[model samples]
Target chain A: MDFQLTDEQRALQETARKYAREVIRPKAAYYDETAQFPLDLIEKGFELGLLNLAVPAEYGGLGLSHLDGVIATEELAWGCAGVATSMIANDLALLPILIGGTDEQKRRFVTPFTKELKFASFGLTEPGAGSDVAGMSTTLRREGDHYVLNGQKQFITNGEHASQYTVFATTDRSKRHKGITCVVIEGRPKGMTVGKHENKMGQRASNTVTLTFEDVRVPVENRIGEEGEGFRIAMETLDNSRPLTAIVATGIARAAMEHAIDYAKQRQQFGRPIAEFQGIQFMLADMGMQIQAARLLTYQSAWMLDQGQKNTLVSSYAKSFAADMAMKVTTDAVQVFGGYGYMKEYPVEKLMRDAKLIQIYEGTSQVQRIVIARELLR
Target chain B: MKILVTAKRVEDPESKIKVKPDGTGIVQEGLKYKINPFDEIAVEEGLRLVAKHGGEVVVVSIGGKEVHEQLRHALAMGAHKAVWVNHTGPLDQMGVAGLLQKVVEKEKPDLVILGKQSIDDDQNQVGQYLAEWLGWGQATFASKAESFDSENEKNKVPALVVGADNKTVRVVREVDGGLATVECQLPAVVTTDLRLNQPRYASLPGIMKAKSKPIEELIPAGLGVDVTPKLTVTKMSAPPARKAGIKVPDVATLVEKLKTEAKVI
Candidate 1:
């Protein structure tokens, strides 16, 4: 079992880590405070070819391996999960098009993304359908050459910023999941109105808002896969994207753990460094253990998918394990920091807040467990 | 006009170095290497000049086979081609200047651009020595990016090629007190400073294409120069630790201590 990263992968990792230190990490706090999207950094990511690394070369992307994307994402997330989330969410939107879109459709939808740092949302979840995809209330009605889209999507990331959206809507609610269709909305279709921006506890650098679509006209050609195929497309896209969430969780875990350890080494209590205490040491040890396991699981899932192996089970494991691990590790990190960690002045609190969302988004830890259990039953 | 830029791969500036137990040298077990920052600027400057004056940019490096990676990086930064001069042991500034002098003779580029100094060895001597060996005028420690007329030879001068290709260029260099601007004829060496220009990241497609670019490796022994070290480091050690300070009880006591004990008023 050769586990060593290839030289090219190592180069990708180094480049990203360097960028994280030099660019992202320094501005992380500022962006988080102002809740401003880092457009320049996003442009820089495009220049560095960090955006759309997995998309094919013909479509103006690097055609990099899935492992390379995971490595890059982890390094960036190490800097700041909010900025990293905003960055990776761009790739999240592209995965569906790359997976299920026809060549002509890819040319129409994904090619423009390669040239710029424009964002796109993965629009499966609505106000009513977070975990239950079949329960999504958004509807699409056929009108000759176009489908009229109407829906209310809540907690949608990059709602006001994305030039396009990979939105899912049911053609027939009676048919449930079988009636779902995935459609690409280009440049914010005329009838779509972006609603109020939501102020979240963490990952604030990302723009999260409500999207209101009123009879938005989308051409039939923009549909990804056949009608009723949206459910599978969404599932497969999540399967491809779940590892990214795990990588982000691992990043938050590592970042918080690192700050806690550094603080511990220097912070003195009772005439000795807090790190000298076995209790603090044990917390650090557990933090380290959790991060390593999450990272390993995340890497294994990404690698399996890259090798064209089935990854539903491992992907769920990574997402579930990493989400829970990040929460525990970050909370412990705050514990290691004492009262200072509870304050906003310290970074551990922010990490703790960010770690909570990982357990809730993409797929919750419970949802992931359900998938894992299904695999076991199968 | 043909522009020649020198590329040097140095240990990553961020990595910490520790003297060996025997006090010989720092551990090189897992050192990360990258194109020195100044050299990256030089390569970028060379690319910019070539872009403005329609010429081929050739990047050259004197190192072992491993330096090919850096050379490819230079090519990826948009250099037209690259040359690798192989050497095994450490060489003094003069030795490196002499080897580069051989490259100058063969390539005979209209202009030679190099970093003011390598970060690994902060000796700012190669650019001067190289120009002297080639009997060409040089401008060292060039001022930051600014565009001024060549007529103001005492102020900031941008390294801009005027009429004939990259033949006649102007540069303003950092001087003892202020700045000195120089307008040198063709075949002159210009050592770039930190502020010349920010180096562009090598694009993915460019890097992929850089792999196929020709890199002609030459043996330094055939150049007929002694590539021997003329300097020695008797020992190596880190800087001394900084001492802690104590707080004074009052301003009068602090003043008294500063005047009598610390000897500063």
Candidate 2:
């Protein structure tokens, strides 16, 4: 029932907050403008132990708890959601291996990332299948000691730059979800090609592209689990990851609220500050309340996951609520600034743009609703 | 070169501070706290010194339990250990210096570094008082070659350089319109100025490592130091609010007001 963060968690939060304020926030607008992958900032974050947070201590990683990871994520997102997204994509990429990989597999694949500043992308979504997991057309075929992968994964974050990929494909498409399998592919093979970066609507600092694997030979040793297990593996990874996503949204909402509060108190109209008006005050109050509620839900879901509890329902609740709340709060922040908030010169409009993908990615708000309802019925 | 550095928990300058209704102190309700900025620099200097000279840095703070936050911050910045002087209630500059002297007598570090002034009170007296009371050589307002570039600060080249003999330290002090250099014998005290070094943010691993670092607690009474405030405040008050300025219609009116109404001319 206690709500206080442990002293170590508080120290970790402070460190992340300081790093975000001093390093990431200053360069956010620049990266967003050029849409360049912030390699330097990412390296700095890696050096600071801000990346690869969930990797086990045995592998030279921080081995931080889910609660600790979310606390750091929120502060980093408060600095810049786009940069934060790029940072956390590594954890998303590693979750599959962590959940299903053997000790040998973890040592071979995950340990290398801890020693260097390299990226590994989560390969799931395809051009044909966004929300429908079973609709993916990526196919895997066995060949003696290896598997041949043929697929096109679209909207793959860190795809162009990753040295490794944890990809999901089906051995038998007719069997749908039950037939899906996951494998780890190291580096680009002869038949594989990385597509040009996508000009995304928001979180543009994060590199997103298409990956085409044509007869890509992956070693059998790299397979995460038994055949027909990837659908659950991917779902579990999401369950473990959704709380982090929800906290990122909370961070964005918190950032937007702070900007709006500062602007409201200073913006003058009708011979006084706009903050003096009831309309603006009410908007701020609602924003503040919703941010707190979303944060509480997010922490609870993350805490439950850390405690080895089934959090499918609560994770969805947190993800959907926080994502929707971020979208609303950032938009309201823009509205609070009136015409000025729409301009590129101001920061709020960028936050408003950056918050859109949260509601749509990971699990869309609609998808989250479906999960919540199904869990309740079950 | 075993070094002792001070970390004083102070009100974050970013937090909006209000004097209490009774004028006893600031309103504590929504206030945030952080290690004093100058003290953070002093800790950084101690770390840099130990890194090159092959020794350890021990950070110490005097306050109630909450001061552990600042002590932990210093530890996370790479201090080897901490000594928390457990006490509460008000303490003036003399009281702080007396307590630190006792801790110094016990720890017996070869060197001590402190912030030139706490941001809250700007007393700027603790280092000097401790040095005088201890009968040790003192160097104050330590600075370095004037540069704010990140490159210069990346390696954290210390301003307080230890001599080749290992018994004396050279300090660059910021003085009026120029920098002065002085050499002090071992077991001396140094206070840090702003340009000593840019403090580093604690890395995640450093924060985790700090959790296991030991913090030994000692009460003022246990140290046989009397922490009675010799300097007492009669009252506290905020500065008067600024009045709005009237706009003059023209240069002639402005000149007339300056000459007559304001009577400055």
Candidate 3:
């Protein structure tokens, strides 16, 4: 099989990489330190069409392929995973509507985002449920021409900033996954409260908070699908998103490895560059090898989705491998820098911090392992 | 005004360059290529001119198939179309000017903008040569009225003021010490300096749109231009590495060394 990206794909990658280097990398540390949402860069990203890659062309969005999305995401992540997460969160938010909403719903909900710079968040995780989707305590009740939504979605990305939210809540908790319903809530309703931004360990540039929706009214027209279909919709969205997550991890790993290489070549020990030592070289080699493998796997999974192939198993493989790889690579990159890596003065420490979340979010490494084993057994 | 802009593929200035062991040329392997930075400025100027005045910016590049990358890059940055002069051999500035003269005869653009010099060669002759060859008025080293205001530069506000008559344009030229303003008539050639404008990045949508834009290919033979080089480099070599400097104990000693050993005084 040929590995060459199409000319258009190459162009996409180049554009994203250039934007990442020129606009995002310089401010990454500042955002990380202050834990501020990068609104200015997000506006620039909107102008550059980096924010909404997967939305359809009919709705005034790029309608880029899954492969194109991941390709661009990798470069954006290389700049800073936190800022990249903030940018890609829009894709995550809109995927549910794209996958399950009607054409009319897409026209009403997705088209406005294309015309201006705006934020939207995917609301799935709750205070009670992290990996267990079916066990979430968020509730949705049928009302006259509207659904009453009451939920506390914690660790929600773009929670405080988003003007729109695609939230998942159950209509009947006893029915487990079958009871879930997906609804699009635009703007804050009467009783909804956005909590303070979480002081996260990594990826702090992405705004994460607890969303408390008390009797938030969602229009009936905003319901994504049948009551029982939210589980399937969320799963499909994650399947589409997992490859992108994997590539983001790959980007972080790549950046860390680059920093390690540059540091190793210049750093001296025993009157010679540390790079001359086999210990450092092998670490670098391992980092390089794993990064390449992760990148290839990520590309393959994303390509499969674009080709309309079922890629759940492969997505899990890529996500788990790339996440674990990033955590290890960034940690080793810190080791390469010795004591300098531990300080805020150096970049590797931030990268090491950033790599930790990739292993834990979008289904933790353990959850991904479970999926892989389940898929294999099936 | 219809504008013709040149985009020359050159080694990226940031790439670590090494002269080949044979001393014939640089090591091409693993070297990154980009559109000449000055040429990129020229393209930006053309686009800005067209943006306000309402016309097309046609970008042209001369090289082998690889130069298509440069052409596409210009297109991605919002050039209307491209003309590729497909030839893969040595050509001096004279040959390049001669070839462009042929393309100019065909396209008949009102203005032709080029980089003052390609970074790789620094042979700032092609624009002047083409202007003389075409018997057109020329403006070289085009800059802004003052030190660039970053906001205006980022917004790509045109530095060159086109006369209300539409047949003349006023340009700020960067002379040896200061700026000189000149007004040239229509069908003129202008070369861009660094301060002309800050070139815009090719947005993702622009890149995708560029993929569908047409690129017409021509050859030197097809244009009836003989590309025999009048200027040839006999050999290539890297500059000598800079030596470490010795710190003097006192200002008097530093002054003495500057006057005698360093020979600055």
Q: Write the per-residue lDDT of candidate 3 for residues A20-124, one digit (tens) a residue.
A: 998999899999999999998888888988988888899889889999999999999999999999999988999999999999999988889999988999999
Give candidate 1 misplaced runs (Cα > 4 Å). Answer: B145-165, B203-206, B245-265
Q: Model 2: share of native contacts present?
A: 0.81
> What does candidate 2's lDDT look like per residue over A137-160, in tens digits?
999999999999998999988888
Q: Please give the C-alpha DockQ score of model 1.
A: 0.39
Residues B1-265 of candidate 2 have per-residue lDDT tens digits of 8999999999999999899888988898989899999999999999988898888999999999999999999998899999999999889999999999999999999999999999999999999999999999999999976577867565664678898878999898999999898999998999999988899888899988898999999999999988888988878898899989999989999999999999999
Candidate 3: how large is its RMSD?
1.8
Best-to-worst ranking by TM-score: 2, 3, 1
Q: Estimate each model's TM-score.
A: 0.91, 0.97, 0.97
- lDDT at A131, model 2: 96
Query: What lDDT does each candidate get?
Result: 0.86, 0.93, 0.93
Candidate 2, CAPRI quality class derived from DockQ: high
Model 2: residues with Cα > 4 Å off, grouped in runs: B150-158, B252-265
With a 3 Å backbone cut-off (N, CA, C), the pairs that clash in candidate 1 are: none
Which candidate's DockQ is highest? Answer: 2
Give a tens-digit lDDT track for model 1, residues B1-265: 7888988989988888777988887888898888889999889988987787778899999888888878988887789999999997878899989999998899989889999999987898999999998999887876654433244433633544444544577887776776677788877899988767778777655666677789988777888778777887678887788989999899999999999999977
Q: Report the lDDT tens digits of candidate 1 across residue range A314-338.
A: 9999999999999999999999988
**Candidate 3's chain A scores what TM-score?**
0.99
